[model samples]
Target chain A: MKKVLFAMALALAQTAWADGGMDILKSQCSSCHNLTGPAPQTLKELWARKGPDLFYAGNKYRKEWLVQWLQNPTRIRPAGEFYEDHIKPGEKHDEIDPATLKPHVSLSKDDAQAVADALMTLKPKSDLIAKEKIEEGTISKSMGEMVFDKFLGCMACHRIEPDYGGLSGPELYTAGDRLQPEYIASYIRSPQAWDPKIWMPNKHVSDMNIQKLVHYLEALSQENKNGK
Target chain B: MGNKLIFLTLLALSLPALAKEAARDNYRTYCVQCHGMAGNGKGVNIRDMSVQPRDHTDAKAMSARSDDTLFKVIKEGGLSIDKSVLMPPWGDTLSDDEIRDMAQYLRTLCKCKFGGN
Candidate 1:
């Protein structure tokens, strides 16, 4: 018991000294995310997304939300992963006693603000995709079909268009009226634990790409609504 | 003359198959360590990866894409293709032909026959 406690303390110490935390993000988060602009072309366009984006940290999220989320992430993907095994159902990890995590990510209050401020600057370069209208009758059923079949590999694990692919995640045919684009965008970039035991792989999508995809889905769903 | 025409058609048909075999061999030698032999993404190193590698056995999913997309993906990597950042690009290690061949082999696994090439 003593040894375990000591080990946790040591880990916390190491986390605290870890360059105030942002450096750790640079090294580890860069794999799936970018803090700057000119984002990758392959970045998820919402409709064809496998992960979420983090470009617009400041605008989309509140500071308290950011801090709490960083400390304890939740699964946000409704359908889970495209493949089954990656999204382990019902698996959850919470604050490792503050001591254990402290060593790895010791963020002072000031440090947290600086990091949050820096994250907010990551926005899309062009407003073409951003200015997408979500008015009724924008997103058509056919648009959903195109998104599911063409751009993003949604059919890989979903049943949105029917017989498109596997059933690893949930059905998205009704996402047109069921979900909000902002929520969809956030979930796409960072999947929180839907079931905790789910087996989905993290894709680390950026915010701008999510916005583009949201625009596509919103338009499709809006079109569906207008027609209805 | 008929025999010559038949021979040329047969060769043309078999050439891509041969190149695909070579690419499969190369992937087995290098990528199989992390990407798996069947491309189901269950390689030995897969367990240790933070982000799981893509499964090549996803036919419908893989079929939806273009050959150039797959080629670029293999040459540049998952990050380059805007997929997973875990997949390292083989451009530095493998030749262009090798990457093309690998893409060909991947198409076979996924049964992707679209996109004029």
Candidate 2:
């Protein structure tokens, strides 16, 4: 009888303790985001998604970026997660009205850390990210720009500078700081695998070009950090 | 019957203007970032780009190109015409009618029709 009572108490304690991260996630993020696996496979499925799939957060984002972003959330996708729904006609460009935009829910530092920790555990495809060491300074800034702009035309959708590049995708100028090198390389290789209906096309870049692009992105991030 | 004919004529005259408006919206949504809000070459990306985006207002330069060429460039991207790869293919994004309208809108920006010279 005593053992049964003790087991019950222990179970209750564990539930309360483990609930810290899960509780925060449920209360805060579950409304708009899908925390489960199986990213949207079709354009129709993608449009239905309100926020980016966080199931692969461990494989995709850097822990530091996740922590910082949770505390002070910002809009990453310029055309929003669903461009078809978010973009409206504007004078200069298709714009999301500032007033109408739903601000990301910001959490306290402790909560952010807890959420980040919890999110890092959501590794659906553990084998997707390879153990590749990123060598910084592998590609020069000029060479990187040429590859990004002239060779691949990545600038059409991704912003390489704060003021430059397209608005449809995430800004790439700070990509070095924001994303894991492995994630960057993997995503560049085939974005469809990560998010099937994503606007980023599979350019069928060679392995060499993929490495060069990742190296360039790393260098660009360092350059931005140096305030140059 | 005469009033109806007049209404049809007015609608016919306004169709091009409506198409132009749609084209303008497409340009704003897709091209404004690299091409600049004023259709100038100095877009936000100018600082990062090795090759400058073409200035749409340059009549002298624009007059040299044919409308069909412009349409092809917009549809197939600069690389299709052996130009810079900086221009991405919009054929996947915009409809053919929209591209035709955009080509027409480009003429307005330069204020010179192709083959008029």
Candidate 3:
């Protein structure tokens, strides 16, 4: 049985090596991404999600950003994929592996677009997206930054820019362009609902605050002077 | 804090040889980065940190805060209690009971308890 499994794995790797895009998703991305259907129903199930669920990538990611990111991927989550994957003894403050994480596989432009196209078809939560509206101008830069950094304490876990915040959560500098507004609001409303036991706290964020945070992220994405 | 059973439990390694080990291991794993091996808050990360990590060895300081307060800071991060955001939450990492153990172990470090002042 082990021999058979090894053979199957070898075949899959060869197939992905020979092609890109959808083939890559099946053979490579499938190892981590849940590409099939319904999201994790429980905490145990959530743990199996080694990478962010691409099953609903269509609903979560912006297609243009996905295309660009696939061509030249960067680290989003400061700690590798999971929160406690590389936590070890005799280290400093929840260290994750080392200086930085290993780079993701880069693809050609055409391949990137192809993968993006394929991923965009996996939209499961259109209802959630339909209710989202980008109500801009409500949160000013200073006010938004104040709430994001202090009031709500998102900056502790999430980074608004490079090397600015705690290194436990995903970076949010490109969240405006990378993620859907509705997704952001929904996630902050309750991170555990999406990925139970995820490091991000619910914070019991108010409805107004959620909108403000989303607004902040959107504005931050727009105000890019440097760094990826 | 409780009846005789609880008192005996408390007498058992001051309640947490197991819990103490857990708290020590957790401190080593998480807090020692900034709190240091001796609970002196002179952790290796201090050089880069803008503010100093709290000195657990400072009996006067640690004693001033209540166990519930310590639990809150550990479980919810420093910002939840209007403290520094630099103190990241361990809610997702450590269990509630574990946090409680950590709070108790902290008492051992300072060798002091809250006087309700």
Candidate 4:
């Protein structure tokens, strides 16, 4: 009878643990993130959003990255996600006090793992990222630089090298180290798909270019690693 | 009458200064990231880019270009001028008046006239 009771208790505990993940998400994350989403369609609606939509978190972020980031949160957007709202009339953005920025809520390792597991299950459009993959060493570093600087004008917003390029967007020099190749391709193809109000405009890049870009990112990351 | 004339002259002088300040503010908002805070072209992105952003403070280089060229580059982008595509077009984002103001501001940065004497 004790053996049977132990087995039953184990099953019950497992079920509760599964539910615990969802419960934690609803209680902690739903306030800022759109856990369920059809990303904001218009700029006005996008600006209204307080945090990045996580409905496609499974497709967008690596599970390991999510777990680590949850435990030790840092600002991803140098300028706030809605930069227009953050820039004061007579001050430089970099001059703004870091203390004034809203801090992201940190989580314990167990909670972060549970929350990441729950978030990974929230993938809605898996098809968008299905075919994207990073192929290593296909494009030379110089060729990738050409595509980034000359062809796409990406240098205007994204930084591929340290201290070079525009600062309006996230630095791309560390992107290969930081992002999934599929996520990079998907975001580049249609930034609005992930966040409608994001300042990045959809450049309608071709599939071939997308491949080249991912390969370039991987190459850049490798270069960064070597340089370091 | 003398006081009124002096007041009018000061106001006239301050108008350009005020406009220049406004232009500087606009530069801070948009160009400072890539162009540096002092228009030295050593922006934060300097390490990432292959081509250097134009240094507005370089009097020799700035004086060589015409105001029309500066206006065109700002409005249409470097691609229009056979320059690097790294400089994105601002025509859709900025008004004609703003571009003109920015060009004037660039002149102040270089401390040189655009047209050759």
lDDT of 4 by residue, A131-199 (tens): 566555489888988887779889877767666666557777767766778889988887755664355
lDDT of 1 at B37: 48
Rank by TM-score, highest first: 3, 2, 4, 1
Q: Whose lDDT is greatest here?
A: 2
Q: Which ten residues in a row have the lowest lDDT in candidate 1 chain A?
A: A93-102
lDDT of 1 by residue, A1-228 (tens): 999999999877545543444564576555455444332222122122233345544434455545544454433333332222232222121101222111123355655544554554444522432433333333354664555445444443344433333344554544534444554664554342111112223344444445555666655545545654
Candidate 3 per-residue lDDT, tens place, A63-87, comes to: 9999899988988876665444533
Candidate 3, residue B72: CA error in Å? 4.8
Reference interface contacts recovered per candidate: 0.00, 0.12, 0.05, 0.25
Residue A121 lDDT in candidate 1? 47
DockQ for every model, please: 0.05, 0.09, 0.09, 0.12
Interface RMSD of each: 15.4, 7.5, 6.9, 7.9
Error of 2 at A201 (Å): 0.8
TM-score of 4: 0.61
Q: Is the docking of candidate 4 incorrect, acceptable, medium or high quality?
A: incorrect
After superposing candidate 2 on the true structure, give the runs of residues whose Cα lies further than 4 Å from its correct spot. Answer: A1-19, A131-137, B1-117
Displacement of the residue A191 alpha carbon in candidate 3, Å: 0.7
Span of 10 residues, lowest total lDDT, candidate 3 chain A: A86-95
